[model samples]
Target: MEHRGFTALGGDCELFRIDLGGGTLAEGEAWVRQMHDRFTRFSESSELSQFNASAGDWVEVSAEMDALLRESLRAFDVSDGLVHAATLPALLAAGYTRDFSLGSTPTAMPPPPPRPLPELLSVRDGKARLAAGAAIDLGGIAKGWMADRLAERLGDNCLVNLCGDLFARGSGETGEGWPVGFGDRSVLLKDMAAATSGVTKRMWGPGLHHLIDPRTSRPAQTDLHEVSVLAATATDAEIYAKVALLKGSADAAKWLEGRAMGWSFV
Candidate 1:
């Protein structure tokens, strides 16, 4: 068994492998840093930043960018437009302009109303475009997507954890499953993914957090503080958890029924 831990994408990251046969933990860490540099909106030189800057014009994109863009569109459809990626403006308006770990002082300002993602973004022929005023922050989607990618690259038996979003591939040393800490107990997961979404961790002020409700274009006001979900992929888990949290306690269970393999709410 081997383990590596570090920080990237504004959160703690970890990689684990059993009887390594594929990529090394060092290489996996490097790959994560590379992806963070490419996708992060904080860096002015990042591809995502460049894309955001090039709004209103079609810009060439790499294969990874194209895939993620398409995944963002799918998330929009899966969550019934609740898990929007084009909420950068709204996030900024909510005073999350910088990484939450670095602390930001948010001013009292209302964000612009949400716009339909499909209408503002389009992709074709290895190129993509966003409307003039439209910008996107991949956020949790990118983390989950990267985790799944890293898991594939790491080995047949490995786990990739980026913050609370993670992917577990293959069985663990015990051959049962990879033991993971959930709510109050440990659950063994094999060839599956888990993600937790919450407002408590990122809150900076009253009613200020990273989770933006696309319906109102503001921080969500929900009865539930957090939600964790299991799915076939980390990306799917992330989308499900966010949607459940946004749906609040009363309606979350019904919406999450049959959508997730397992779920817990707080």
Candidate 2:
């Protein structure tokens, strides 16, 4: 087996293609291109983008989007609503709204006094409802979901990486499973997705960053710098990471233990 890597789906995506029994490079490229055309949010016709823009009623969806949202919502419910996309405006108002840039001068943004949680959450007819004053930003689960889908599409012998997080389906020709490293943290994965969430990588304020504690409806005051969770799916890992970060190390560990999910905090 030979491994071929390429950038596709979008400029931000990275994919690895493994040729079982030594297939042509062109064939692998074509397969990747097809997957990107179907999966990338920029594809315009993807069911996800359509759903992202839909409002007011249950937007009828294909089975794929339906499954994605359904499973993602499980994370929402489990985190006690801590990890939510409807709070985008609140996140921005706290100074995390800007594109992440290193070495930039920190702004003198005032601390946003605590505000009431927006009434933008509700579920009806088996679908999540976005309240009149809420917005849906799927940055939390979108990438992980895409990686999971790509792993499924590639079957039992490939790896999929979205930005930094990675999910793998099987080992390569070297008889080693997918090995992914982020900064100083590296891990092996086999049919699993590892998602990381933290405030260390985001902009800093007086004592706050992007990770907000939705439990108190404020920026999380947890002292831990980072937290990573391992679960059956990337969506689970992603949600657990955020939930753990907001809940703090002890509470996060207890929560994961109760749920039987793997986690690490630093």
Candidate 3:
């Protein structure tokens, strides 16, 4: 069985149970909504918006916010800065100031020089802060992270797909693993997760997307059409898949093995 609903992260939240018959779909929607309320960029009063507003100031945030911040930071490090979360400035400059479905509003301002997120992020106890002129957009990872987190609330035979990013727990009805169709082939997932990232989904202007190249503060010009990765968790899949897609081909392969993410594809 499958259930779908609009997500706070600008995509649909899809909950599926292999065997069906679980009365958790509504609860899963609620969980997804709760995460959206806290993390959505569309809401000015959301926790993430508050945190973004407090840039350059050490601000108090919810425990959930702090936890996700650290996770984004970890993604930043593991991807060698290719998958940086602090690309808000770049995104805004590219006319992605609002949701992609809303159509682009051109902005000519160039983004400020890119900086490593670790240099700007400071998280201690339950408080977090960013350096002056720094901002972070968790849209890069929150969907997958929230999917992984919500999977714990689901049954053993469940799959969570936040937009195209996916996570699988127990085996589906097939009894072997969850069948995920990608391109010309498919993969079985058991006690694992997968995610796909590409520049095609949310493009604006000539070639603008949430995936920004730190070296130029512009959308990365990767040659891969898309990347799919099955990993230990949704967040890891999101991070590594994106990194692989951004790197492209031989370099992406070497990067994945170097990072011990041999399951990633592009």
Candidate 4:
């Protein structure tokens, strides 16, 4: 059986089951909604939004939030700061203050200045301190994280695809693997996640989208429009995809040589 949904995480989402056993499909939906509510920056009441609003102050966060933030830091490190979570101001400057699913908003705002990683985050003891005048948007990592989390609840015969980030459990009905496709390639994945990032999607202004270059605090001028990476988890794949796109085709290939990653770029 399969189910599809839209308007969650500002993109299409789906769940597929094949002899599933661990958790009910409804439970998956509930978890998605809950995470969406907590992480979405479009709402003022969201935990992320509250954190963004509370700049220069230490705010307590739940375990999920702490984990997510730590993952963001890891993404920052792995990508060499090419991808980051604290890009709310940059996104707003690029005219992405509203949800892209509702269509684009073309208002003008000041672009965020480049910031060091230490200036972006200070997390300890289940609390985080956002630098003054800095804001964060977890949209980049949150969807992939949600995909990984949802995949854990399913039995050993299911697939979770949330906003193009995916996690599959066990092999498909044929026991080969679940096939996932992206630029110039298709991967048969079982008990793994695949995430693809693209600059072409979520366009707002002349050159703006969800992906931001931390150095310039604007849409990265990447040679590849899209890049896909397969990894053990969706968040890692998502981070790799973005980093690969930003590094272009050649460097991405070199970076993937020693890593257990399969990538396709265009």
Candidate whose lDDT is highest: 1
Per-residue error (Å), model 3, residue 126: 1.0
Q: Write the candidate numbers in order of decreasing TM-score.
A: 1, 4, 3, 2
Q: Which candidate tops TM-score?
A: 1
lDDT of 4 by residue, 28-70 (tens): 8888999999988889999998998898999999888998888
Candidate 3 Cα lDDT to native: 0.79
Candidate 4 clashes between residue pairs 3 or more apart in a chain or in different chains: none
Q: Where does model 3 exceed 4 Å of error?
A: 1-8, 18-23, 258-266
Estimated TM-score for each candidate:
0.97, 0.70, 0.91, 0.92
Error of 2 at 253 (Å): 1.6
Candidate 3 lDDT by residue in tens digits, 173-224: 7789888876458888888888888878777656666677776787788888
Q: Residue 253, candidate 4: how far off, in angstroms?
A: 1.6
The lowest-lDDT stretch of 10 consecutive residues in candidate 2 is: 109-118
Q: What TM-score does model 2 achieve against the real structure?
A: 0.70
- Number of backbone-clashing residue pairs for each candidate, in the order shown: 0, 0, 0, 0
Give the Cα lDDT of each candidate: 0.91, 0.60, 0.79, 0.80
- Indicate the residue-level lDDT of 204 in model 1: 91
User: Model 3 misses residue 184 by how many Å?
Assistant: 2.1
